[model samples]
Target: MAIIKVLKRENPYVQIDKTGIDDPNLSWEATGLLTYLVGRPNNWKINIAHLSSVKKNKETSTRKALLELRKYNYCHLFEIRKGGKYIEKFYLVFEVPTQYDEISSNMDVELKEGEKIFYVKVKKERNSNNLPEVENQLMVENIENKGVLPNVEKPKMVKPKVENQALINKELLNNNRMNKEKNHEYDFEEKDDDLRKIEKLFKEFGIDFSIKHKIKIKELLQKNSVDFLISHFKKQYEILKKKENVKSIAAVMSKHLFQGTCEVDSSFLLKKEQENQLQLQKEEKEMKQLNNALQVFLTLPMEKQEAIESEILKKRKEINPQIKKISTFLFHKMIVSDIEILLAKEKLI
Candidate 1:
């Protein structure tokens, strides 16, 4: 395949570190999500719901990508509390992972009057046996003597001896492995329960699910709720019952449950058209009956119409005492219904 590339030099571009984009630990989804988040303005509020609302970004996928970012330290979630009550939570995005504390500590040295604090930054080697780097420090001296204090000799560092360090490490590793296995077993049981529940649902609908159906249901569950899946299944079954040559409901469901496209036969379309026509005819008959009732009510004496309206209002208030007012449209609609019942009893319509 031939490839063509074009570059655009524009102000509407985000500058991201190549390290994060090319990180092996992150998937493409996570990398793209990170870049999108980093490009937003500093004051822009961050939220999962808003992020998921973007085109082609679903809540499930966005949440999974966020988990990946959090795992690699590309993002951090913090909760802000006040008066020991939870206020809100926020996320912090980083170009790369670095070791630092959220809250900074003050220097232990005392400051003299009229003296300024001189802070220093130190870069330490990664593997060197030295103290960690300090972000801020004050260089203070005893001012009473009018001279800088002499440097004290640094204490020699020592490593404690552990006779069974190797055995301890092995035991810890074994314990970690056992705990992981237990967690895995629990997860497997939960998945089995979900699968069985889905199977039970299929059986309740008089449908048998195959291995393929089971796998598809698992995938559907990842992006949809069980209720949604069941609703779709019922709709599909209802449609399939009307279509001829549909041998297996489960087979058809595996293809079209949550996001599948369905094609109905001409006969099914004809049947649906007939059903719609019947519905329209039924509505027209009801409308004619209602209009006849309204004409009869209008011809009645003023006192008779008022009696019907009062009866309706009394019954409605008896049922719901909180109803203070009714709209004109609804009141007339209810008046028409009461007139119809009254005329029907008198064998008028």
Candidate 2:
């Protein structure tokens, strides 16, 4: 996989501030290195180091160009450690990469008799997703100092209308009065002849009878019997109660809510049960270990056992890993150790 062609003017040129290299403070070698870097892809490596010393001003020219780029916030240098050695590379500061010459892992460059450049590629799949970090400390520090975080917004909250509050309270009290007349879950169990009974039944459940849920109940009642609707609603209510997921009295009344669906999707509850079982198993394992450790300690000589307990309670774990000014984890660990030692000592006595 090699192609050799005569190098000429770029068919498509990059748009950059060419006058940057002409600055009086910049070194002469910076202009050459900048041109060389802009010609290659973002994944390119500087090849001027391999040139003859007489023809080149040395690799310091390339270093100066890199320094200029860093000073202007154009790119960032990343050092990766490999085999006890460090390999340095530069990545573009901006997200959009500049790539004139696409690079591959085994690709190499060669100069021809003329000013032609050759590209050699050992074909391989394009690597994506696990790319190097493009963002640097400059981006983060700038945001921090300027108070510009990635996402900062307040959540919109629902507010009750003031005028409706008194009316809603009165309606709720009336509904409670109507519900008290009938002790059953649904009062319209045998009285489905009139829509008034159905409306009262809907109001008893704290649901609005004027909504689409009222229409839904009417349709279901027409299709099936009143007993069927009551049975289904009870089943749905039981499922919600079992999961301890009764969101609100309002949600139970709305057709869009889970309670209105009248379906026993136990998979959600099963997933929660599985999680609880795993947590219980972990807790049992920890208790078993603690009990075993206590039994072992009790078998030792009384003075040695007391010495071991004292040592265990006195020596704290190293807190080097903590970077916070005050570590709550270390404080909690100390409290837990004291409780555990006290309990074990009481059991032995």
Candidate 3:
């Protein structure tokens, strides 16, 4: 039997189950990632990009680790959808394999006004370093009730009598709170800017939306990102403008604002535009070459031009013994163009 040694400390700590650390199904990278994520506050947002930013972390490894965790039921991925459309996604970390039937069953229900259900599952039931005392206790109780890692006994925590240590923890907690507030404020300013840009776009498009319409758009912004919404609305506006019977631009925009059919992937549009540009460039170059070839034919002596045309005409006669009746102008035009083609192919231009 392996003997486990327990240690106690008054400083901040994150509780992770030995069973999780010793899980044979998980690789070292995945286990380490789970430990780091479990140590963050419940409300902390996590993604592969953020995880890869940690020292000595690689994006490919982090992504694979997340997939591995998901496969083993240690991490749960949920899509935050509104009006039957996907808006965002988040993950929930658990120290032990968690039953996800309850969470999955609630995912399909449409959200009502002023209702918040996802946060309860994500943030309200967990605690980690820097959590408020009330929440921390609630999480402790919840974890105990769930019977996760039942083999590891809870260690008794004894606070040190040092005054400076208490003061330092207090100061660190306050600083964390301040930083969260600042980030919240910054997000508010950024959202305000997005709203202003959308308003300007509406004006440019001659869309006369009422205050009610503006409120509806603002609510949509909360669910979808500014860039996505802008792209969707712009494409919808263009489509509506081309319709012969479109009566109201504002009405059309409002109608399709939340509809999944109106959603256009901006990257797809950019790729299509690039392909069209390349085709146009190719055509222009070909036309330039054709014109240059024509100019070279004009500079050739009359006798030489006649000889080239005769050679082409002979080949045509052999292909079709009798030439089809064509207008004199068209026949001459064909002969000259063929001469140009022949000259260009022969490097005579």
Model 2, 28-111: lDDT tens digits are 665554555444443334433542252455444444454554444333333334453543332432112212232222223332
> For each candidate, what TM-score against the reference?
0.27, 0.21, 0.28
- lDDT of every predicted structure (CA atoms): 0.61, 0.47, 0.62
Q: Candidate 1 or 2, higher lDDT?
A: 1
As for candidate 2, its clashing pairs are: none
Instruction: Give the per-residue lDDT of model 1 (tens digit) for 1-349.
Output: 1010011112477656677898999999899987777666543565677788884867666776776776676765544455555545555456665222421122122234443323212222242345443433222112112323346899999988889999989999999999999977864675677777778888877766777777677776667777776666677678787777888866776566545665455676789999999999999999899989988877889898777767765654322111113123323543577678877887877
Give lDDT tens digits, candidate 3, residues 1-349: 0101111122377656676799999999889977777666544655566778884856666676776777687867655556655566666555667556633543433445643334323223233455443422323334434623235688999976876897899999999999999977865675778887788888888776667656677777778998997887788787777666778877667666545346344667889999999999999987787677767876889898668767876765321111112122223434556766788678897
Most accurate candidate by TM-score: 3
Would you list the rank order by lDDT, best first?
3, 1, 2
Q: In candidate 1, which residue pairs get closer than 3 Å at backbone N, Cα or C atoms, i.e. clash?
A: none
TM-score of model number 3: 0.28
List candidate 3 segments past 4 Å from native: 1-11, 102-349
